[model samples]
Target: MSNELPTVALVRLLEGARYEVMPTASVVDAVGEHVPPSVTVTVTAAPGKGLEATLSTATTLARAGWPVVPHLAARMLTGRGELQEVVARLAEAGVTAAFVPGGDADPPAGDYDCALDLLRDLATMEHPFTQVGITGYPESHPTIDDDVTVQAMWDKRAYATHIVSNMTFDAEHLGTWCERVRRRRVELPLLVGVPGPVERTKLLGMATKIGVGESLRFLRKQKSVFARIAAPGFSSDRFVSRVAALSANPALGIAGLHVFTFNQVGVVETWRQGMLARAREERVHPTGRGGHQDG
Candidate 1:
């Protein structure tokens, strides 16, 4: 592939891609006008709003003809029955994908404690979902140590079909983390997380309120996050370019991107279309054989 392939492939990955949405009151309406029927929008589990809110929102989106992936926070499940109900609900709606994570609820809501346990349960249940995703930490999770996260990834490898990395502005950190995953032989395809253009104040406030601890710590450790946050609105060009440059090898198995829209659906949609248009004008062609340039 040529030097331009990385950016081109990155744009291809962004096309008709997945964007995450929080299940707030205005979320559905916010996404209604902007998100197309073909794109997948993963509804996040909010501790304050409850898992029902997340699943309900996801099911609604799925019914409306959009492919939806809802966050099934393990802490929210009470037992096999609740899991079965959720599974049945998804099947009824024809939703085929989900993102499972150990939610940040203090004193977990029920029997399940972590994602692994819930994944085990899901494996045993007869469910409609074929694509199940687990979380990955690039700059290290704020609550868990790095080593534990590595082992957890290895353990969850059997249950998870893909890994959606938590949001991070440090491209180098993501590069190193992906390399480590390769060394460990965790073969799950990666979905790099990037936040779309959003208001600085709203972004910070949401990040803090959502308990994405790494976002706050990353802001302090990596100046890039702060720089973007300090700006009028966040633009993913710099962050996406650096990460794509570092992950230019197909061997890295980065399947696509996962944008943390944070319900900024309209702004994110505009940004994505602009990036795709720019890539086309630049003629960032990639040879079919070496789709990714040498990393």
Candidate 2:
């Protein structure tokens, strides 16, 4: 049995598949411990807060020699001139990509109501980013109608380089959504969202502090049926495996995993390394010549 891990193969998988590995300022040190310098880490500004905070996080991380992508939430910018300043700061820090979500910011700061609107504004900017990622909902959004969500994606397609799915736990639903995106002619590569390797207790703590429980409620309400999230743990292993399986399917066009590290960077990195090791070993084992050993 060949238990050797293929470094090149895994590197390609990581590079091709991953969208954003989110790391918060509170856990910036943890990011240094876990995330490889090769992967881009996206630092998020608290929604509705000004771009200064997000830019600061991105600047710090970029200075640390890590490729950093800042989330430029829609409601954060004051105007076109403010947008230019934000872009200039990001460019100065060597950030080539950013994630723009219709921020939860109430009453909006400027003209943009949603991500699509922000994308429109960004397209007109002189310093347009080479790579811009937009949110995709495999599950229905809490407040938005399904038809509207679909239409919004179509509208943003020209501005977006990739689609990063919002966090959804159901793999079957995710697979189906990938098909839907393809059917709708959404050719942008997808980064399947998965919760990271945080234990249930700790995740609950962070979720409460970060208002994630409310977000989870929003997701559950959008789902066809409510699910009691399986007990005592959060792991991206199954989520990553489901995504890797989809890589064999030519039609879905799954690009990679976007781990919602939720500030649990160290544990998530450990989980990824372990799975990649197992996957590599399984691929080489003589006993399982044609079978997926990881399964």
Candidate 3:
């Protein structure tokens, strides 16, 4: 059992679980209560309402003592001055990491159109972070062409410290994508992304509100492949279990799980704790190789 601990013991070592939350509701209250004090919590604000919203959320979270990582959506930044201001404000709040993405905003406000551009701008400003996370698409992006997306990632690798995969449901696809990343020499550590502990009803509501429902409907008109997309978005215990399967392999270079909590922080925290306890128990009593049965 002592020897078995190393195989499964890591399951309980989630001292700094990372959670992504939207700026809705009383986020600080939720963070203070449900989120463990040791964990890092990120709040995201997209392009519509602008960078002010993101900075406000970042400020509040920093004051609350969570290591805050705000998403610096490329399209949202208006110009070099705005970008500099954002970096300065974040630095003031003690933010060390930022996830840059080519945001979904229509009509770019500045010269930057994609995350790569933003990365370049930030580099020129000499404002490097302790961690810079760039998005990776294991599953195809709805808007970008596959070839362009992969090339964009390779080009951005030098500026990023890690790659956080966008939402992916298929474990096999994720594994394959990881192999492709290695084959391409994109050496940044990966943080597997998945939805967290959201109820089906809530997920559906969010999807509808965010217009993902319309996108899926459009896809359905094109091909039967859209059937999978028809289902409401929600986290799968099965998916988490599958990802956990890779825990023992250092060669995988997986940093950890990145949960897009969608402000369902309380629920995911409980789920994380339960999984940790189960894995800890498995460690006490030896589990099969890879803990496949335990999962």
Give Cα-based local distance difference scores for all models: 0.78, 0.67, 0.71
- List the candidates' TM-scores in order: 0.86, 0.84, 0.85
Q: How far is candidate 2 from the true structure (C-alpha RMSD, Å)?
A: 4.7
- Point to the candidate with the largest lDDT: 1
Name the candidate, 1 or 2, with the larger lDDT value.
1
How do the residues 151-184 of candidate 1 rate in per-residue lDDT, one tens digit apiece?
Answer: 9999999998999988777777788789899899
- As a whole number from 0 to 100, the lDDT of residue 260 in candidate 3 is 73
| Most accurate candidate by TM-score | 1
lDDT of 2 by residue, 64-147 (tens): 888777888887666677788888877887788888888666667887777777778789887637889888998777778878
Q: Is candidate 2 or 3 superior in lDDT?
A: 3
lDDT of 3 by residue, 1-295 (tens): 1232333425633434588876654677877889876787776755544677678987888877888888998887787888998888888887888999888766788888888888998988856379999989887887788778788889999999998887777878888888788888888888888766666555555444434544354233323223343455423555666766554454566667788776768888997887677666666675566552333
Cα RMSD of predicted structure 1: 4.8
Clashing pairs in 2: 17-255, 17-256
